[model samples]
Target: MIATLIKLLIGLLLWVGLAIVAARIVFALPRVQDRIDSTALDPADVGPLAATLRVRARGQEGKTGIAMLRDGADAFAARIMLADAATASIDAQYYIWHDDLTGYLLLDALARAAERGVRVRLLLDDNGTSRLDAELAELDAHPNAEVRLYNPFNLRRFKLASYAFDFFRLNRRMHNKSFTIDGRVTILGGRNIGDGYFGTGPAALYVDLDALAVGRVVPEVSADFDRYWAAPCVHPVGPILGQARRDGAIEDGLAHYADDPQLEEYLEILEGSEIVTRLSAGDLDLEWTEAALISDSPAKGEGAARREDLLSARLLKAVARIESRFDGISPYFVPGRAGARAFKALRKRGVSVRMLTNSLEATDVLPVHAGYTSKRGTLLRRGVKLYELRRKSASRTPADTLGRFGSSGASLHAKTFAVDGKRIFVGSFNFDPRSTMLNTEMGLLIESAAFAGNLHDAFDRELDGLAWRVEMDGLKTVWIDPESGEVTRDEPGTTFARRVVLRVIGWLPVEWLL
Candidate 1:
């Protein structure tokens, strides 16, 4: 009986191994190769908006017109306005585009633009849009619009199965977020298309930032969009989902959003938005400055040779130029050994290094918070001034007065860093191993003291009400609430179950994956 049981166990192991091998072989098969459409579309050929922007940018030369979008209402309104005003092309890319209220609103706006003879191209990461394959395919049925999924999964219905077979290939994702209109104007930063990103959700609202840029940087953004759009890894929706159905679901979806009573409140907010009013009147206050576009190569995910042109390397070089101070704000910050060493080195050079990240209670991803907790002591000991955002926070800035709707909670979702109050870096790049080695990211490094100083001042103003100062009391870490001066030795506001789960997860060897 013991010999028979041993043989059965061996047989089971063999069967499992065979199944894994078969799955890998099937996943390794060449992906569907459809016709490559590499036709170039110029944004300059767009309507009066592009022409006006070009004329305004002519005298600036290498400078770009940049306006900060801090309010969620204004951000959403700006996108809708750009889509409405676009006459030639609208290209958008995001890491996450949920099928929620804000998502449908943006989709409806894009579809209406396509209906008006404007060309629309949307590229979203496959992992973020996997559940919306049929809906995206339906949207692609529009004559003037197209949608593509980046680094798509082979088994769309059973994505978990594909993960088991192609973990290496499926792990890397595109974390870029950008919106371009008429090839002349673009907005890029951290916010994704979802209700949580905007301030319209019943749940937590994210305090985020996006820069609306025009002029010299517009062409650079357009080039990046074209590169991703033409990459072989991007799969068109029509081919993936086959012949598009002519069902009226797309129309129904648009109508559904239109009839939403909450939209009236949003529309009123849009009408009163200062950015929208200024944009509509052609009198936006845009600061013209020299900005460098930094982005990871698409080849980063294609298993190609490691290139020196990676965004992480460029960002490190940029950070090395800091002489006085460094202020980093990231929603998911997991600075590993290398990052700790870098921060220590900076502190040795007399550079005051500070960071503000999501707290245990504020973080949406518990694993990432655990990853950060593992290195909290090391960072504090290395003289890094760390601050964690609170679940309840005040407005980011005085200008962000338009979007307040008494949210259930507030979470820090902005990804920005400043160097000596001279330069600012903003985009989707997080201070984590996943962003450093596994994901493709992008950001704008503006060499303008005015913009950097403004950001720094805003950070100072929001520090007390929105964050808790973290410090080491001898060997123990403590969180001091900046508002009431209250102290908490434990993870503030987290439940017992969550704390236990986080403790278990902290023991896992998955920091790199987080």
Candidate 2:
């Protein structure tokens, strides 16, 4: 009996030892070896025409129409241009294109472009377009247009195991938005094609931005598009569907659905779909600037730029170069300790800083809001002017304006920043860690005084009404303290579960993946 007990104890010790070694090996394999060196723009790549480009700052149609303010306007403009001209081909890549009015409008615009005898190539992430299978097959029926889903997981293509085998792979999504019009204009940035982004109606809207570039920048955008188009991950729609033979009725059903009288009513709700009206009405004053299209070149090594992944680094470098002041605004703010320290160093340099992010109640993602609120005290202590947006329906602010038949209120989704009234950065790059580390984001670094000043004025005028200033009281920060307006002090600790989850996540060495 004693010998039997000894044998059992010895076996348990061996199992535990093996488990520890296996865990260490698994963790070590995924660990990133080094930090990426920030890349710089090549002087040759800046192009000569950019030197002569004239840029001016223009306001949006209304507070609720902020989507028309950025890439939505540009994309709409490009689609129109393609429809009007473009005899050869058109290509677009996007991460998200919601199956709402805005998405349908884009679809209609593409159909019109095809109707005008233009070959249209639409590449969308599988994760984004999988649900729109019926819509996609309908678009594919077009003789001149082709819609392909990248890295599809559907069993129709013999990829059934891909669905059940791996779930984490889905999280590593194709978070890129790019479009090329007649190989002339290139629109790249973070704004997905949806009404929520275009200020259709404040349903947990995110204040985001995108960039539109003409001239030489378009080619770079085309290159990125081509890379993804050629990638094995992106399979042709015709071949995939050719195998599935999903049936002919799906197209007829979608056509009938499009003609539904309710769609007209739905269109009214999505003001962003009125791209043609805004463009024809001269809502967007096209600004030309000395802008060099910056993007992440394909990854080579520890610091090598990855495909459609370099824009984040370029934006950070631009932020780092700010000499006098740095103002940032985003709907989401998830800056960890290192990011907080970076802001602190900027404050230490006597740089007047201001930032606008969503409040707990204003945010749709409570956990993300919690992550941001966690850093409020740290940010406030460093002299950062942090503002949490308030619900405009409840509060009487000067910025509120009745928009779209008193239905939609303004939600700030504009990703813009101004530096000393000289340079401005606008596009999809956000201040959050997710934007910085994981997601591949794009935007324009505009060095135009006119653009910067106009954005600055808009922000100044809107902040007083649409947002509440975050201030430090003692150890905590407050958004709307019943007594002291918006003050900051010590915040409550995270729940035990959240703490445990965050601790485990913090140890993950996937900064490259973010």
Candidate 3:
């Protein structure tokens, strides 16, 4: 009888544990939805708005050079802001806005706009800024600037357990970048705000990329921002600020940070870039062409309510369109068998697919390479053009810190693709399971012969100089280990165990969750 009682107790405990987990999952969703819904704004009609916001370029014609591709971060930011100022309203969003020197400068600019009543709305991912609650409150104090966090961890309610319990929520991040100004011009691509993004870091500056669009497409970017603002993912600053109850504490803190020397220098460097001057004058010269605004969210096509998000749907569309040539560059590429198969299909259709991704030695996430290496055979078999970027030569000198500071140990973090040398895409969508199935992503598809040609030339330069071209051998192929810079013939015995392990783990299908 005692034994029976013990068994019953054990079973009851197990059931309760399961119940708690399920309850927690259910509890988290509404909180996420409430935050997303609060900031929702009506999507403005961008066509009529575009003309009013469009600023014609004037004054000195700047020197156009191929080297401008490596323009510094300060230059990029300043240029975009100048393009944005021509707008009637500006909407900017990102995952991280650091508290460092660069962060304050950008914040100050936004604050100035708010003071001018530029109708500025800034949406930031909560996980990246969770620790900066106090800092955010100060920025929000800008009368025209309203800042909100997407799926924030409510420090007041959740408290000590919040960090631990909020892991799941933290995983589904909003990895989108869009800056729409005056409802006319937009810059959409894979940059976040920080020293790392702007080349002002102590480490190497990343070879990142962004796109400038002017015409019918800016509105689509605006619509996506409005959707997220109103979605259940974003939460207002009121509740968290109210909980902190620091009152004017945030505003004062922002003022102090805004005056820091690092920020002042960063801003100065930015304003001095030729690109900044050109963009400020609204002088982007290009023929208007086809473009599409793509956004990824757990709530994808069916919108935010459904269980499966639309990131994959948009990706598949991009892939299907790649029925011709598949040219891609992603910071992270862990192509599983499924991803390999997709590439294979393109190859079968006689598409010349070339990809450039980070080397394992340069990759920040080693485990992702573990997944990528396992699938190289499939990619090579499909005749896809594959290349991995080497760490830039240490002997190379600095070009211009127009993008960001720091240039010693940078790795590639760009997510871009060009199809048929006509259509191109750039944004936060990495070619990995996380981007496909978990985190919400965003990118802009630009159909511009001019822009596409420019990007194609850039890709060629990287292919010839910075990338290690992957090629096939007889029955086997060649694998180049980045760390060693040694080429080894791919035979039966090369890391076979590692391949087996990856196959087993990848077969589980939970990597998308990971």
Alpha-carbon local distance difference test for all models: 0.80, 0.56, 0.61
What CA RMSD would you report for each candidate?
A: 2.7, 9.0, 6.3
What 10-residue stretch in candidate 2 is worst by lDDT? 59-68
* lDDT score, candidate 2, position 240: 51
Give a tens-digit lDDT track for model 1, residues 1-514.
Answer: 9999999999999998898789877755446476466443676554557656766777799898888887787788899888888888889999999877778778888888998998889999988874566668777898898998888877767876788767888898999999998878899999899878877746478878888988888889888888888877777876666666656545665566676777786778667766645654568988888888888888776756275767889887765677987888899999988898889999999988888898887788989999998999999998998988777663432353113435647777888888888888889999999988888899898887877776566556646466788999999999987668798888787788988988899899999898
Q: Could you tally the backbone clashes for each prediction?
A: 0, 18, 34
- Misplaced by over 4 Å in model 3 are 1-70, 74-76, 79-88, 154-169, 243-265, 280-282, 301-311, 315-324, 394-406, 455-462, 471-510
**TM-score winner among the candidates?**
1
- Per-residue alpha-carbon lDDT of model 3 for 301-337, expressed as tens digits? 2234343337567656754565456678887887766
Ranking by TM-score: 1, 3, 2
TM-scores of all models?
0.92, 0.69, 0.77
Q: Where does candidate 1 stray beyond 4 Å?
A: 1-14, 24-30, 257-259, 274-277, 305-307, 394-405, 459-462
lDDT, candidate 1, at 320: 61
Of 2 and 3, which scores higher on TM-score?
3
